[model samples]
Structures are given as C-alpha cells and as structure tokens.
Target chain A: MTSGDRGIRGVDSAADDFVARRRGQASAPAAADRPGWRPTRALSRAFVVIAVASALGVLLGRVDLVILALPFIIGTAVALRSRPTALPTVTLQLGTDVGAEGGDVHARMRVANPGEVPLSTAVLRAGVSPWVRLRQGHGTYAASVGAEMGNSIVVAGRAMRWGAHFFGPVLADTYACDNLFHYETLPAEAKRVRTYPVGEPFSADEAMPRASGLGGTHRSRRPGEGGELAGVRPYQPGDRLRRIDWRVSMRARELYVNHTLSDRDAEVVLLLDVGVDAGTSGGVDGKASVLDTAVRATAAIAEHYLHRGDRVSCLEFGPRVRRLRPGTGRRHYLSTLEWLLGVRVADGVSSDTRLLRSGALPPNALVVMLTPLLDDSSLSALAGLARAGRFLVAVDTLPEHVRPEHDGVWSAHAERLWRLDRENAIGELREHGVPVVRWGGAGSLDQVLRDVTRMSASGKAMI
Target chain B: MNDSRLAQRYHQGRAWLRRTQPGAMAVRTSVYVTGFLAVVTAAAPAIGAARAAGFALVLPILPTVRPMKVWPTALIVTCVAVWALTGEHSYALAFLLGALLYTHHTSAAQAVTMRTDTYVTPEVVTGWARRTGLVLLAAAAASALVGLLPRLFGRTDAIAYGLAGLAAVVGLGGVLAWLVFRKL
Candidate 1:
C-alpha cells in the first residue's frame, strides 16, 4: 500500500468525500497554508543550492565540493526537528445520540499553520488501533509547505457506536527533514473527545411504577391501600371486620368481610448487550454499535426508572460484566455513565451459566434484558432465567432486519448456521414466556415494555 | 491492574519499535554501526581490523544467512564502512561519508517482506522471525553493491557525495513512500 500507486483503500474514499463536500470550494487564508511549508521550501532551496554548488565546484575542478554544499545541508537539517505548536482543528460528526445501540461517528479535521513562516512540508498523523477501521482518509500525507496553504484532512472509519471512544496521541512530521539534521516538528498533546449517547424517551405518563414500592394504581397482594373488596378469611381474634368479605357472608348467610391491598413497586433492571458487532473499525457509523447505543440506552432506561422513583440497576455484560447495584438517584446515572464510558467489547458475549440459572435472580424484580442475539448461548441462559419467574422483558439488540451475507460456500454455511442459531434463540425465549422486543421500533425500551405488557398482561412471564 | 498499566506502557514502547519500519531502523543502525566501526579502527587498530574483517566476511553471506533479518542491516553498515576506509582521507570526512552512504535498500526490502508476512500471520510470536534467513542473502548482495560503488562511481573528490546523496534519496524515498501509503 505504498504511495507508488494512489490506490490506497481508505485514503481515496476519504479524499473523494471531502472534495465532493466542498465542491472544490476555496479555503480561507490559513497560517499553515501561507509560507508554513518550511520543509517543502527547504527541499526546494536545498536542491537549488546543491545544483548551484555542484555545477560551480565540479566545473571549476575545485576539491572543496563538500564545503560548498554545507549551507544547503544545514537548510535540510531543520527537517529532523519537531514543531513547537501546530493548529489542527478536529470536529467529530457522531450523528445523533449514542442510544441503546451505538450509531456512527465521523471525525473530520483541518490542519492549518497559522504562523507567518512557510511550511517546507509536514505530516499530521493520528494513531489508530485496529478497532476503529481506517475506512478512508490519509493517515499520513506528503505536502509541500509553501506560503499560505491549508490542507483539509480527514480520517473516516467505522468507529464503535458506544458513548465515547478515546483517540491516542497524534504526531505531525514534514518530509525530507526525516534526517535528524533537518526535521521541523511540533509538541504532542493529549486529546479527549466525547461522543454523546442517543436518548430514547419513553412515555412517562403511561408508566405507573409497579405498585410494589413505587406508586401504582393497581392493588397489591401485600398490605397497601386500594379501593377493592377482596376475599377475606375468618378473623382470628385479632382480625378486623374490614378484612371480611361481605359477599361471602351474603352467600353463606354469615358475617365475613373483604380485605384489600394495593399494587407494589416494580424494579427495572436494564441488561445491556455488549457485543463485537457494536464496534467499528474506524469511525462509529454503523448501527447499534455496542458502545454507541448500549450506553445511551442504559442511561435512558435508568432515567425512565429513576424519574418514577423505581429502583434501577444496570448490567453491562460483554467480555466484561459491569454492574451497578440498583438505586434511585442522580448519582446512579453518573455511575451508569462511568460504566458506559469504560464499556468495551473484550470478545463475544460471555456465557455465564449463573445468568441463565432459573430462580437465581432476586425476587419480585422485573427483568429488562437487552442483547444482540447473534448466539444461542445467551438466549438459552435468558430463557432459563425467564422460566424462573414471570415479569421477563427482553429487548432484542438486533437491527430491524439484518440478513448476513454469504459470499462463498464456507460463508454460506456460516450464514445458515447463524440463522439457525437465531431462530432457535428467539423460539426458546418465547417458549419460556419471556417477552422479546426487537430493536428498530420507536421508543425502543418503551415499545418492548408495552408490547410485552400487552401479550402477557394478565400473568407474569412464564418460566 | 497496575501491572497491566505497566504492561500497556511497555507494549507502547514495543509498538514504537514496530512502527519504525525495519528499513528505517536498518538505515539508522547502519549509520551507527559505520560510526562505531570507524571509531573502533581509529581508536583501537587491532580490534578495528579484526572487527572489520569479521564483518566483511559476514557481509557477503548476510543476504543468504540462515536468518536474513539482521543480515540486511549488517550488510548495509559494512558497505558504507568499506568505502570510507578504502582510500582514507581526513578522519572526520571519512566518518561522515561512511555514515551517510549506508545502503538502506536491503533493509527497505526486508521491511516490505515483514509487512507482507505480518498480513499473512499477524501474530508477533513468530512473524518477525519467520523469513529472517531469506533476508540474509539479499543483505549480503546489498553490502557487495555498496562496496562496488567506489569502483563504479569512481572515488573522485565528488564521488562520495554522489554515493551518499544516492543512498540518502533511496533511503528517504522508501520512508516517504511508507509514510504516504503506510506500508513499506
């Protein structure tokens, strides 16, 4: 992939994109553009001086050829040094929010030499760890630093869609001065850019906290106030008459009244999916990238529960599992963000059997699980967990419809295998009475809750 | 975790080694070797002659050695030293020209090979060591080529400069090419 040919994979795509966007529009006078090309000019001067020196001494038969070229040599010497300060403005277009599933992020920057001196030639370089694929743009460039010239450069890639990704150090160098004697260089700086998560708002008005601890309209099995006359048993000496069921008394011709309790609060557990598919090679421009969407979705879900005073906890499971014990405060949100910021897909989703063990979960908690069901192992575990209790709500992290591509025989086989696993996973979840909500619907979390609420409204999720 | 942090920083430094394409490293190594050998000869003649003769023997075989990786870098250094010491001039100029004229083509080619092999099997465990033998013969040839420049280019007063410039251009060109395309 040397410059011997311009057919660089990612380089051309990026350059073409920029040219098209600008429509060849002229750039304003940039300091780097104007006479900032010290290296380029230096090379030009070096060549002229050498040519002048070579012609004179050799033609004159002078033995001091080296002495004559000394000045030119010194001129080229500056190329080896680093620059003190360079102005390069980088802006990221991380479209919309990070959301429950990560989205796309595009980073665009222009390197300008604002100083009055010309640049001979310079290379502005930023490092990339393969996670962010270099889709298009010049990671390194060869330019002639002339008086007043500005070059707009970009590095575009499929970045993880998570909330925020960190960029490593950037190094800028000029051509020819690669020799220590002549290099012009600049100091390095640490950069931190935040890619905010997408917020998926749910309808607050419709949500009545499950009347367990939080407020709700429905009466509960435990002692709580409600306007219902439930069945009553014969009062032991301490039993109140209000606890008697009058209708039973009328039917049996005996005095027995009814006792009633209101619904209790429901706990919301947001189980986020941290899968490899959620990461990008370069910029986070893909759909439902784990970092991009999961973090944002988790935040949104946390907000949904916290606003209602329902206890909320988050489970970010990928290669690593980050859990925040359930809480109902602003601090919980901050803690969740901290986890999101640090969330990285180490590998495939972990297949911890404990997560799948039925009846292992805390009691009376509504299970809100999110995942990109690419594998059956996670599905199986969730299904087993669902069988342990009702109140199972599964949020599918899959895009609206993703049909895996099969290019060759092996790939076709792989694709079929994946499809088989997918069908089986969903089927198992449904069988166990876990309500599954496929992503891509508006109000992703809310839709899942509402749809699951509708399909199994009367009974808790079947184990 | 602290150990991991230390490992991370350590890995970063090691990564820097990888980032420095083998060709550039070879050229740098050759320059240092040339300076070092010149000093060995100037400072301690017996050691210098022995060292020079030993390297001269290895220089030709370097390109075809069992491990070609170091052969190229070694060959380049030997070639530059050969010219500098052949028909000696003042000590300073000999050192300067000797250091400058080291042939980087051998190292450059080796870098390309490394990159290609890396693509095939990115694991660092055996990747760098795989084709080391294959590079030895090529490095030997490069050393021989530099040794011949004195005869071919003619050791006139301007001769070394031409040789040094040519070497510089070729070495820098390879680097510039790598910088532009991110591959050697």
Candidate 2:
C-alpha cells in the first residue's frame, strides 16, 4: 500500500491560518459600523446607452430610433430615483457551535436595513467547508426588508465527518428600488463549528495486570476491606464484629478476622502513535483508514478503561508530545477526545523521550499503545515503554482489508510483503514480552488483557 | 460501445450534478433559459428575421462562457448598432436589450455571492425575475409616453441649442451620480 503523499505541514499551516482568520473575524466590529453603497456597471451601461442612443436618434432625425432608446432613459431615471443614506447591516449566527458526526446545524443570517430607503431585494450566501454538507433547500435565501426593519434566513447543514469546520464570510447583495444601485458588503464574519469524533460502541471489562487507585471495579491482590476473603487473620482491637471468622476462631480456639482483597482502581496509560496515518480514509460511512482506526480505538479503549473507574492518561507522540495526565471522569474523556482531533503526523523523527522522562507511568499501571504498526518510530516507542519494565500491550489498528483490490495482482503481492514486514515487527514486540492484539472494536482487547493478567499472576508484567 | 460503461458514465454525471448543486435543477434551468431568451430577443430587432435565426446558434455557447463583465455593455452596443443600421423605431429592440442586461447583471451578482457548490433556490430566482419584470414594464410604459411626445428634430439652430443643453444636463447628472456613489 502507498503511504500518504500529502505533507501534514501544509494542512497544519492552512488550518492554523483559517483558525486565526476566524478569531480575527469574531472580534471584528459590526457590519453597520461602515456604510458604503456603490453603483454597478449595469447602471453605468444604462446611462451611457441612453445618452448616446438618444442623442444620435435626435441629431439624425430618426424618430423611431429615438423612441426605441427612451426605455433605457426611463430605466436609468427610475434606477437613480433613490438615494441610500446608510449601508445595511448583515450578521450571521449559528444555532449551535458544537455538533457530532452526521448531525445538522442551522445558521441564521439577519439583514437589517436601518436606512429610510429600504432594500427592494437582498440575496445572502454563506460559504461552508465541503465536510459540512448543506441540506436540501438550505443553500441560499431571498428576502426584502422594509425601512428600519430586519429579515433573517436559516441555512442548515450536516457535519459529514469529525473535526473543526467553518462556515464563512457570509456575503450579501442588496439592491435598491429598481435593481439598479447595489451594495455588496465587505466579507462578513465567519462561524466555527466543532464536530467531535464519533466512536463505535465498545464493550470490554477485561482485567488489568495491577490496580493502585483508591477506588475501582477490578479485584486487586492487595489486602483491604469490602471484597472477597483472602484469608483469616488474628482478630485485632479495631476489627468489626462482621469481619470475625467464627468457624476459624472456634477451630483455632482464638479470635480471628477475615482478610478481604478490595477491588481497586488502577492507572491506564494510552500511548497513541500519531507518527503516520497510512491508507485511504473513506470517512465515516466507508472503510476506516489506519488513523481512523487508531483514533477510534484510542477513544474506545479510553472509554472502556474510564468506565471501569480507572484513571486513563493519553500521550500522543509526534514532533511535539501532547499529554493528558492521568485523569478520570466524563469530562476528562471529552478533553481526551478533543486532544485526539489535533493529533497529526510530524515532519521529522520524534526524538522526544518526554513520555519516559516525565515518569508519568506509575508502578503496576497497564500501558496500551494504539498504532498502525506501519512505522518503525512508533514500534520503537512501544519497545521503549516495554523496556521500562511496564506492562504494555500493542493494539494494531491497521484495517484487515486495507489492500487495494483494483490495483491488480502485483499490488496484492506487494501487500503480502508489507504484511510480512508488519508481522515481523509484531513478533519483535512479542519476543520482548509485549503482547500484541488486533483492534476489533467491542472485544478487541479482551484476549490481550487476559494474557497480561496471567503474566502479572506470574510476576512477569510487574517486572 | 459497451452498455454498462455508458450507463455508468451517465450515472456519474448525474451524481456530479447532485454533488455540486443539490436540489437546484429547476432554478438553474430557468436561469439558462432566461439567458438564452434574452439573447434571442435582443438579436431579433438588430439582425432582422432571417439573420436573427442564425444568432440562435450562439445560445448554446453562453452557458459555457464565464459570465463576462463586458456582456451588458457589448449587448447594449449591439442594440445601438442595430438601430443605427435599420433606423427602425421599434421599442421591442430596446426592451430586448434591457432584459438581457437585467438578467446578465443578476446572474453575475448571484455567481459572485455564492460558491459553485451552492444551490440556487427558486425563491431567489423568482424574486429577481419579478423585480426585473416590473422594471421592464415601467420602462416600456415610459417609452410609450415618450413616443407620444412632439418631434423635436430639425435643421434649425434652436434645435441644435436644445440638443446641446440636453447633453450638458446629462453630463452634470453623470458627475453628481459618480460623487454620490463613491461615498462609503
């Protein structure tokens, strides 16, 4: 398979410029602050044609030709009858600024004519990103506003995919009484709509190798209150009556209490390999690309771990490493998702060892690295995490049917070679005791989590 | 020659139209038709009956050309040239040129205001048509009124003075309009 020919640097620069422009527009003054009206070329044409034609007809003594040219004279006179004292103000407002994939948003544009000469007809158009598809019959609107009155029209669209999209510089063309004199506004304000990535439903309650948090759902090996009994111990002064092992005490002729292992929460470190996104991105409805799979898998894994009362921290490594330090709660999940949207491939090799240098990986915490397994840098990062003696699992997010079918048999053979190389990488991680699992959405991580639990039972994951 | 290929190409074309201009088939068709009719109407008086039929061949090319800014001026000049050649006193020719200018201006304005992917709503088309139609009607009424007025053309010095005064008035109006329109 061919890697992406597009450099993320260009996309990043364009996105940055768009964001900066939108920011500037948001703080800009209202359209009504500046009032400018101008005559179009059509009006000038009317004037010239009427004057020249009428003069020639009269000078040449052709009464019929003179009659023919009078309409233009009348049209020009009617067009010039009105004088616009002030420019009309046009403003655009979005119904809601945030949406999910495949969700609709309505943008309302208001054109207010504060002048005495009301606009006879006004056409308003809003430019939008291709990712944000306008719904049928919602592209353009026509309205006629009276003197000192306001008129508004709604342009509705649906967010076809995830990411931040903008609908822009709403343009307006306002005509005077005879459609002669028109006023076109200098680029109106732009609106931004942030669409969050939609994730597939993932159901995985797999066990983690270790638990260290104060509260959780996994059964830990440590002795504590409020769980299944670990053993019986000699009764202490502070022991409650409910904890007394009466049968064991009778057999030993001494007072004893039951020792229970409480279910404790653990820290989950999610390392996202945002080094490269391979394959074609068919968007939401079609096949998921490598990056799409990685992102969705990261979201699903984070959601699963967070739902289990475990603190999940996400680290995306590229030229710059973005870290969401170990956090738990619905709000943290949202913040993590928002961070994932900004993750793009870096230009150079990521030499930043900040993830290991920061010592954010706590003892006994299970680390899961989501990657496409196509880039060596990401695998190297995985190897580094494993070498730190932390329990790590490599979740391969490459789609199984990623090979292009229309490229003939040679491409098929090349795909096989590439797959062999990827397998060798996975095998290398496995030889270092890092388990690899293919992401299958709902139960993708179950088997790998079970393996980690078993290895931890043998004191391998912790070592 | 293959049936499947032809069918696929046809479907692809349809899909492209739907993608670029969703739900705008009727409105866009109307614009094209109006543009062609205006051209045909303008040519009728200028070229006479037989030659004007030949002008209809240029109708197909109009949709393909980028709406040029010089279209209105060129079309008005064509009408003037036709009147100069025929010296016919037909207001119909003037009406035709006026219609062409009106539609061309509106089309260009719409193009500037919207993206190519945007849909052209029927309401916008109908609204512009109604406004332009009223202006045309008003101009026709004025033309009829002017036709009823007494003839002023003669080989006399008084007539020449009158014509000169009219030119002076027109020049002044142009200057005043320019000043007012330039304000921001």
Candidate 3:
C-alpha cells in the first residue's frame, strides 16, 4: 500500500480507539466505594449543643435553656429521619472531541442522586483549560437535587486558540439532611478536546515547477496521455488510434496525431522554522505571533495543494525536527492539521540541521519554508538548499508590527538594526536564487512559483 | 524576618478575600450579623456580657481567619447562660431567644457548607429557608406544650419534677447515641 493509504488507515484506527476509550470511561463507576450518609461537622455541632443544653436546663431548672435546645432537637431529628444511603454520580460530557479555533464547545455536567433521599445541595467545581472561556465565569456551583433526579449544568464556551484543551476532573460533593450529612464523589477524568487552527483562504494559479505523479490537474512538459492538447504532429507508430486527428489528417493528406501534455501531481514540503517566536499571540481574534502566522499559513498552503491532488508534507525546523510524511486526499489534509497543533518552540535545545542532509526530502518537491527570518541558521539553511538546486520558496511569516521587548535605552535602535539585518539576509537568499516572499492570504507565492517553473522549464540550475 | 512572613501572609489573605464573590460574601455577612444580633438580644438584660459576646461574634465574620470552629454555637450558649444568670424569667424572651438561636444555627450551617467562591443557586437558599421555617414551627409548638404542662397538671414537687426532667434528658441522649452509632 502507498504511504497515503497507511496514513488514512492510521487516522481511522485512532478514531476507533477514541470511541472505545470513551465507552470504557462511561461504563466505569463514577466514584470510589465509601460509607454512606457520613455526618458533617455541622451535624456533630448540633448534636452536642442539643445534648449539653438539655442537660444544663434540667440541672439548673432553666426553662430558657431548655427552650434554646428545642430547635436543635427538632432540626436534627427531622434532618436525620430520611438519610441518603447512596452516593450521587457526577459525570462531565463534552459536546465533541474536536473543535475549530474561535468555535463554541458545549459541555454538560450531570450530578445525579440515585438514592431514595433528596440532596439539600451539591457543590461542583470543574477545572478548565485557559484556552477555553466558559460563559459561566466561575468554576464552582451549588444546586439542590431531588431524589432519583439529576442536575445538568450546561457550560458553553468559545475555543480561543488551537491546541488540545482539557475540560474537567470535576470535583463534586453532595450534602443531604439539610446540609448536616455530606458525601464526596470521586473526581472525574479530564476530557481532552482538540481545537484545529482555522486556515486562511489560499489559492495558487501558477503551475508547480515539477510534477511527478501520473494523474493530476497540472500539465507536465513530457508528451503523454492527458486532457490538455499541446499540438498536432505527424503520426508515430506507437501513437494510439484514438489520438489521431481526422481533420488534421485530411488537411495534411497524411495521418497526424494530437500531442497532449501529461497531467501530473507535485510534491509540496512545508518547512516551519520554530526556533523562536516573534510576537505575542492574542488568541484567534487577536494579533498573531510568528508561530501563529507560520502554522496558519502552512495550513492554508497545505489545503490548497492537497485539494489539487498534490502530495503534501510538513517538517518542523526546530530542536526536535518533527516530520509528517507526504500524503494526499481529505484524510491527509486532516492529518496535516493535527500535526500542526503540536508545533511549539523547544526551549534551551539547539536546532538540528541533520534532517536537511538526511536525503528524506524528495528531489523534485517544492520546499516552502515558513519562517520569521530572525535566525541566521535558518537563512544559511535556505541558502544551502538553493545552492543544492532545489526548488525553494521562503515565506516570511513575521508579523509586521512586532517589536523587540527590552528594558534597555537602546531597545529602539537595536530593533531597527535587527530589522535591517533581516532584510539584508533576505536579499542574500534571493541572490542565491531562493525566492523569498511575505506570507499573504492568497496569491502569496504565485509569482515566485511562476518564476521557478520558468527556470525549471529551461533546465537552469537554481544556484 | 517575622515582618516579611507577616507581609506574605497579609498578601495571601488579601488575595483570598478578593477571590470571594460579592453575593456570597453578602450572604455570609448576613448570617454572621444575624447570629451576633441573636446573641446580643438574648443577653441584652446583662449589658456587660452582651456587648462582649456581640463583639466576639464579629471575628467569625471575616470567614478566612475564624479562630474557632463552633463559634456560632458557642456564642448562642454564652448568651443563653447570661440570660439565665441575669435572673430573666420572662417566657416571651425565652421564646424569642429560642427562635433566634435556631435561625442562627441553621443559617450558619448552610453558609459554611459552601466555599466563599461558590455560586449558590436561589433554589438552595429557598430550600434551606423552607426547612428552617419548618424547624422553627416545630420548636415553637414544643415550647407551647412545655408551657401548658403547668396549667394541665398541678404544681409538682421540685425534686420530682427535676428527676423526671433528668430521665427525659437521659432518654433523648440514648436515642441520639443509637442514631449516630448505628450508621458508623
């Protein structure tokens, strides 16, 4: 089977495992076994007050003391008459395991009292990830529950950023007997919901520099079977009978065949430079940082190419050097998105350049490096790939309004110098025959790709 | 060095205070104030002890730094002792103190059950109110019955009446012990 087929199968099995795990969790007991109807401090206090007051009143012949103790006796006896014998079950259910950035996620917490006695109050506190903004504002809540009934608290919130966010490990306690007796439920397991980054709209009209696969939309230069007609030529012996142009044959008084360019697919490699993040991310609606720009732009580019039947892959140029193998189709697009969510800056670890020299990258693939042009190592790597005659395009993923954060008085001058140095590096990379373009939503890489395609057509070396 | 530690504790206490919800704080403050009022009213005839107990009840109002666990019950007991020692024999005052003491106990129980940051539903508050009202009604009925005992039966010897009250108290204690130990 092809790599794409294996990737699709892997995604299917992962989805199956997720469903099975959820089923197991649902069948598990809500809380650990414990004694039922335990007395709270309040109950003990009431009993002590009642016993002591009654003893004192009788000994001292004080009717007022006896009067003071009457309420405690009545309240305690009435409260303890119908004690809850079973623990309440608490479960937190998420609406979905997957969400889009800036999309709403719904969660329901059910506090069910299965016992015959009703609960006076149940206090619930849920721990939520910072990425999720719960509409309820606070995590702690108290509500009364009836016998054999349940309280369902629906929490709806918007996902602020793209990542795996946890929703629970909810701690709950049920108080019965007028808040005299209480029982605690075991903490529920935290639920993980992955929020996928919303890719910006992107499309490229330019043809790829190199197309290798047999079936696709791009017209290849080699003469073979395809839909786009190149020209009519004198009939060759190996030409199919269907390819013969009857009108051309009659006009030329000889057998002529239609020559069509082969439609073939190309490979697109998205290289993300995660060595350093430039700006501060303000979530999905706020100002996008360097890493944010890189991730979102990679998603947009991957979607554009994958939709056109091209093999797309991702490589993180960071300390870890993570890689996603080339694949195609809708499932591969989803896999690419899942892969992007884990992108983060690896602190204290130096970037490894071994992946570039490992020959893992295909010779004919177009390498689109998404970077902030901040690090010298990344620039040198781009220059090396260009010198190696690879079809390379460097996309500037830095936010325009980003400024250096420093307490020194020379901060402004330092920032200006850094920007100038970055501009010079870009110029050097372009001089090395690497096309550097700033990342915009659509047509960002069209002119660069067109120039690369023309150079490839001429069989000229990129260096 | 002690001052730094004290400052750290002060900052932490302030943070805890800030985290408390305004609505929850209001409810807790109301319960504490009611308990203080009850203590003051019960010991009103003894002005010295009444003022001291009322001032003592103010400490638990802070919630976070309460030095005593059973402050509400202790204050009520102190007030009742003051009322008895001051030679106050008015039945009406006894009945009022009884109602206020029960109200304070029940309200304080509900208040301390939840955390300061907890958002308590109106249903919980209303249910507690309803239950407290029922208990108060029961207490009032019992008080009235005890008062009628002198009218229904002729005045008995003090010794015999005291002995009978002692037996009743012992029987109630036994019943309470059985109820508590059976579950354990």
Top candidate, metric DockQ? 3
Quote fnat for model 1: 0.00
For candidate 1, write residues A1-463 as lDDT tens digits.
Answer: 0011111123234434433332233222323344332223223333443454344434443323333233233323333233323433322222322322233434543445554434433444454323344454324333334334454445555544333443333444432222211232332332333444445664334343243564544445565455655556554576576666667788887766456665555567777656444322222343344344445556677776676567777776555566777776677766666565655555655654545432234555666777777655567657666665546677666554344555577987886787787777788777777767764434655655565555444555424
Give the alpha carbon lDDT tens digit for every residue of A137-176 in model 2. 4445556777788888778888866666677657666766
* TM-score of each predicted structure versus truth: 0.45, 0.84, 0.85
Off by over 4 Å in 3: A1-35, A348-352, A406-408, A454-460, B1-29, B48-57, B64-91, B150-157
TM-score of chain B of each: 0.29, 0.62, 0.77
lDDT of 3 by residue, A251-325 (tens): 999999999999998999999988778677767888778878888899999999999999999998877678999
Q: Give the lDDT of residue B150 in candidate 2.
A: 44
**TM-score: which candidate is best?**
3
Tell me the TM-score of candidate 2's A chain: 0.87
Q: What share of the true interface contacts does each candidate keep?
A: 0.00, 0.24, 0.64
Clashing pairs in 2: A64-B89
C-alpha lDDT of all candidate models, in order = 0.45, 0.67, 0.77
Task: Please report the candidate that would top lDDT against the real structure.
Answer: 3
Q: What is the interface RMSD, in angstroms, for predicted model 2?
A: 4.3
